[model samples]
Target: MSELHNHADRVLSVVESSSAAALSRLAASWRRSLVRHGIDPATVQGPQRLTQRELNVLVESNDSFLRSATPRVDNLYALVGQSGCAVLLTDARGIVLQHRVNDGDAEVFSDWGLWSGGNWSEEAEGTNGIGTCLAERRRVTIHRDDHFIARNTGLSCMDAPIFGPNGQLLGALDVSSARSDQTEGFNQLISAMVEQTARQIETDFFRATFPKARIIVAGDDTREGSLLAVDQDDLVVGATRLARAALDLPTEGELRPIPAVDLLGRSEESPKGFEGAERAAVMRALSRADGNVSAAAKALGIGRATMYRRMKRLGISEKSH
Candidate 1:
């Protein structure tokens, strides 16, 4: 504990003297955040959560994200529960939309202001994982003593941003532990796991939003990239952050109407040609229509006989309800 105090003192000195060059980039950034939020590192207090009514309004406004993130957050909690970690799903604004904490540790975490409907934005809480990740728009692990606030020195947190099908910031996935040892490097492992889970949530959101589009899982290692939503004409209609990054797709501006060949490294001449694309489109349409051949065919703007012929040629067996 004395060591944490010393580190905090050093950080305060750096912030006071504007000598952040001595600290690592991450630590220096935290000091900057402290300055930006007008938080005194030396005399920081615990965070204040929203009132019951305000929290309720915030939660209700984010109903869609809550529904999409609940299962993923629950599964993550189950995986990390043994480690005394709490998993949180927060909206883009850093309001905790969903959280999982073991019953035994509930009181301790609640005392730390780590609970559902709690606000952990960078402006509210000095430099923790969920808030900082949302502020920086990146994955980060703020380990013990790395937080700007001395009051939160006992906590360690890893967080990753989750993007929606439209490439908007949906929220963040966070894994936090009350006890973290910097030397143990447990937080590093936790960071990787949380990032993977965040990607999964993003991919699921993309698929849910574009069930009728050909969901292309493309990358050097396809599973690494978030799924991409391609239209019947081989246009990129939607992409996950991972997909955008992996395929070197546009990071900014609209992504739709972008050519699939440009992103997927394949064309009509390739063995996996337009034939595969058509097959994927047909299957997705059928799936979206719930195996109603007439509806699926109409959605594809084709007659029923043509649809069945294409499905047969593509070896796609359909129930044809």
Candidate 2:
């Protein structure tokens, strides 16, 4: 009632007479159109769930697969890595086999869980690349609204299925990025690249791994996880209930996956002293300060001279910023 009253006021107040025909007409019949094109609303994804045991199985299980497959997985990673896109390989059961991501993508891509042994299917994660590709054994474009998680509404993923040596359904391979609303040509190009990668994997699997030439393989492969959110420095910021329970972080702002020295430089003033959650925030703060002594000191609540001394000790410099 309040909304209708507001819309009616633009035409005239209740005090005004019916002499205003144009205003009356607009007020009487103005309605919003709610339709979409090209995309099928039924393209919604189905429910999916992956237990910690499953993820642990995937991580521990990859070495054998990698050993058998050899550099083909490496080549695929190199190919996808060429485009600066995140790539993942998943088994027929939707368990992630291999994940090759660029060093520069960890910040925006904190959610590597999408391909980390989680379920990928229309009925599982929604109309996603890995899931649909697994089901269709073909290529697909899973755009933003097509995601199950709200935070993932900004990503787009392309997926293709893979085959084993004896024509068995091996898994799916995928190329994913946050900015997929690119040109139609780009989408086509992504699909083509994914197909090529799948072929390369098949080629490698056959010539090197498989002894028989009679085997033919077919079709397809992510995004989003419940892992806790961490700052670049690896400090836990916010986490999903699932993440906290899975990783066992004591607090919301705690650290789970500790940042390595290469990614987050070791602290100088108190690298060993700053334990628990403090380390992630401190590293992130220093990085953002650009190694500026004055800036970092202020952020850390220490003196500028102290900051420089700390930087010298920590081995992190302005260049690291």
Candidate 3:
């Protein structure tokens, strides 16, 4: 037999040799163990019938060039396959389109008895992010006990609602995982996975809408910052000198007025002052303000609200002078 085949056979043999009682006890132990890990019992949302329009659109998108370029967005379940989390994708109509459980996680998740075609509405799944985002059409993160199901209290999920060309509600994307890692901060891993999935979706959208364009306007993009695109909007639909000032892009300080689009393909292998500039902005502003936020706001050419919000977002805090 081929080496790969032999490997597979060995794995199968190991699995097959496992006793039936062992499996039963394992399943039983996992049921409550997952609960202790934060699987909200009440919010164990399953799948539901999708609307005709929603199904048609998703089916088309699933077969589009975007799918060819980036399969994970539509291959929602596959992305998180057996990683101890579940990835769900829904349509504009609150119908669940695709669902996938992380590898090795299927057994634990199946304990919640959440299957395909389950409805996750507050009326059904209650207050959970996936169902709630679909119901409210917003981005949300649902943690333990937030789910309607008391037994589902062990799961934490981060979800974001998607949009189409018309800014129409397209669907919801989410990552659901056991809350055991929350103490270790690896729960952030799930959030990062969701963000990557979102980025792929956005990238596909950009490629489809502007096939000939090289620039991308990924708003608040993660690679470096936001992306810039040059459409026929007449106005420069991208970052301004203020943004350049905030990020302290060294190239810009050198008199190069790089638009957001220019940075799309620019990888962060070089000394791109992302971290330094971010910290410098506060230091420079605070220095100018002598630690007075109101003064810093004026000097930074932003509103006080904007200044405070940035500070909070950046984890910067100081006593008001």
Candidate 4:
């Protein structure tokens, strides 16, 4: 216990003196968390979970988000399961909407309050990953003692902010390890991977939300992710962070929901009109359903008969492979 206190005090001293450290950016955030928010680093409390009724209401309200992000979150957990980490998706305000931990690491993660319905907001947990990422509005890694709260000093967290299609802050994705002694190199790698995974989730959400738009995947064709949504009028309606940055788009406050001509400096390829858009939507639904017409119709919220008629008019093949 004495050794733990010494380590915490040393971290605080570095932050207070503004001295350079391996985690200088995270240390700076911790300093602000303590000074600006008046959080007592030594006296920080544990996460406060919502009541069962409150949790149900919150989940119901964010039903769309849960549906869109759950699959990706599960994939992320599978990738990092061997490393004994917990993957979490939180709402904009830092409520844990969903989370996953390997069965072997479940007990350890639960002890650290890494379950659904727990609040990790800055106000609730000080300079932790989910809350701090939301506060900084950027990707960040809070490793172990870099956390403002002494109680959380055992956790190492890498988090990325998720943005909505129209450039609004939606939520955050976090990969947190209960192991404090992981090499800095490993943590950096985790941060990079987590950032990529978050971007993929954002892209998926954008595509699902704007099904009728001409979704263009920017960047290399060999690699997936990074997409822009173009409307039937050839206007750039939405873009992921990867797409916006790769395309040199104007700042978030400026270019969103604007024309592709304004930013891409070119008109969209000949849009096929409403028929083309509808056909594309149906095709996308079919693809999502693995070419099952019944499932595709259900996904598109249309009757099977109506879907068949639309498919016939749009010239979509009836053969489901």
User: Which structure among the candidates has the greatest TM-score?
Assistant: 1
Query: Candidate 2 on 197-296: residue-level lDDT in tens?
Result: 6766655554444232222111010011123233344433333322334444442332333333322243312223354335445566665554455786
TM-score of each: 0.76, 0.46, 0.46, 0.75
RMSD of each: 8.3, 21.9, 16.8, 10.8
In model 4, which runs have C-alpha deviations exceeding 4 angstroms? Answer: 18-23, 217-226, 242-257, 272-321
lDDT of 3 by residue, 26-76 (tens): 222223323333333322235344456755676676554335334765465
Worst 10 residues of 2 by lDDT: 216-225
Task: Report lDDT per candidate.
Answer: 0.76, 0.52, 0.51, 0.78
lDDT of each residue in 228-290, candidate 1, tens digit only? 777655556777777777777776445545556666667423226778767657765775576
Stretches of candidate 1 off by over 4 Å are 1-7, 16-23, 180-183, 219-223, 252-254, 268-321
The residue-level lDDT of candidate 3 at 288 comes to 48
lDDT of 2: 0.52
- RMSD of candidate 2 to the truth, in angstroms, is 21.9
Error in Å for residue 153 of model 1: 0.2
lDDT of 4 at 138: 94
RMSD of 1: 8.3
